[model samples]
Target: MLYQIISFVLEVATSLFGGACLLRLYMQHQRVPFGNPVGRFVFALTDGLVLHLRRVVPSTGRWDMASLVGAYLLKLTQFGLLWLLAGGLAAVGWVPLLAVFGLVQMAISGLTGLLIVYAILSWTQAGSPLSAVIDRLCAPFLAPFRRILPLVGGIDLSPLVLLVVLQVAAMVLASLQQSMLR
Candidate 1:
């Protein structure tokens, strides 16, 4: 029970931090002003690790290497926590199979983040401050898709296509994780 609680807490922390890092990367790519409330919120959430990582991970070209590394490290920490929880389960004489579950959870979180970014952009188009903030925060991820997809008949379908691709990738990752557990 204690291990489960700890794992859950850690997982949430990892996801939030990772999501914030991704958002920062998105903002940097979009050239958005980062002094607003939403930007401040994201920065506050991730500043600790990001500040430390910035010294070690230099930016290359247009990419924020620190944010990418931060996200990956967050995921790895979540994985490690889940692995520890699995061990705890084994100590309790239960079948320890949480690693795959953790991977699935992480994948779902990532997919949800993508969807959220899409939704925010959509809402921004409809004129909302929060949406605008989110749009700026997610611009990096959407830009490539937008360029590849373009607009059709005055409607943009990049988000839809990207969502589909993200979902499919999530499914594949989940399947692979499950197979590894087995």
Candidate 2:
């Protein structure tokens, strides 16, 4: 029970910090202004680690490599700590692989979350302050699906399609993780 609680807390912390780092990378890449509330929040949450990482992994204009590296390091730390906490690092070779897989899983989960919020805000508060931010964040992910899926009766189905794709990705990641155990 205590392990479960600790693991849950660790997961939440890593997810938010890692997710914010990734968001920082994406927003910078998209050239989205970081003056808004959403931008401020993500920066505040991620700056400590990202700034330190910036020394080693320099950003190249639109590409904020530091933020990306920071997020990956956070996932690596999370998986490493969890493995240690769970009693043993029996299979040391799997740590890096798990960390990489975890980072991919986190990215998928984060994008799914943004899409969910974007879809909800589109229905409830279409003109809200954060809606534009969410839309910009979600646009690239939704674009390819949008072109392929198109709208059904004026209702966009891309979000639904993206959600399904994310779910399938999650399942595949889980299977890969399980396979790594043996």
Candidate 3:
């Protein structure tokens, strides 16, 4: 019970900040301006860790490596604490692997979420600034699918296809993690 509670709390905290870090990286990669509400929120949530990491982890091309590292660090801390709570010292060596798995899972989950919001906004609030921001973010992920799948009855199906792809990726990642742990 205690472990569950701590794990839940840590997962929430890690997901919030770690998701922000990932969002920051994607926003920068998309060359989206960090002046809107979502951008401000992400910057507020991640600036401390990201700025500190920026000193050591320089950007590669347009990618914000520092934000990516920050997200990984956040996942590492979460898995490390959970390992400690479980008193699994014998398997402590797997903590880093678990962290990597967790980070990938988080990325999958985050992209899933972003796509959901983008789809919703497209249907209901297509002209808002936030919608534009989301459209830009979703474009790269959806482009290949869009190229292959034309609009069905004038409605874009790229989000649905992308969501399905992400789910499959998540399942495959889970299997890999389980096998690696074994």
Candidate 4:
């Protein structure tokens, strides 16, 4: 019970901040302006760590290395703490490997969430700023699928397809993690 509670708290905290770092990285990659609410929220959550890490992790060609490293560090911390709590019985060396998998899983989950929000906003609030931001973010991910799938009866199905792909990726990730651990 105590372990569960601690794990839950750490997961929530890591997701909130680590996910923000990842979002910041993506937003920068997409050349999205940070003046909007989503950007502001991401900055608020991640600025401290990302800014400090920037000294050590330099950005290269549209990729914000600091933000990526920040997210990875958060995952490392989360897994490291959990490993300690788990009585250090398992393969301790796998903590870093698990952290990498967790970071990828988190990115997959975040994209999945953004797709859902994009769909919802498309249906109910098409022209809002938030909707526009989400649309821009989703566009790159959806473009290939949209090109191949096309619209059905004037409704986009790419997000559904992308969601399925992400699920499969998650499953693959889990299997890979297990294999690597073993």
| Tens digit per residue, CA lDDT, model 2, 10-127 | 8899999999999999999998888999999999999999999988898887899999899888888887887888876677667788888888999999999999999999999999
Per-candidate clashes come to 0, 0, 0, 0
The digit string of per-residue lDDT tens for model 3 on 10-66 reads 999999999999999999988999999999999999999999999999999999999
lDDT score at residue 57, model 4, on the 0-100 scale: 91
Write candidate 1's Cα lDDT for 1-182 as tens digits.
98778877887787777777876776776677788876898789888888899998999887887887787777666666666656644543212234334444554566567566657668566476667676554565568998888689988777677777777877877787668655
lDDT ranking of the models: 4, 3, 2, 1
Candidate 4 wrong stretches, greater than 4 Å: none
RMSD of each: 5.1, 1.4, 0.8, 1.1
Please estimate how well model 4 matches the true structure, expressed as its whole-model Cα lDDT: 0.95
Candidate 2 to truth, TM: 0.94
**Candidate 1 similarity to native, TM-score:** 0.68
Better of 3 and 4 by lDDT: 4
Where model 1 places Cα greater than 4 Å from the true spot, the runs are 88-111, 117-125, 136-158
Top lDDT model: 4
Per-model TM against the reference: 0.68, 0.94, 0.97, 0.97
Question: Which of 1 and 2 is the better model by TM-score?
Answer: 2
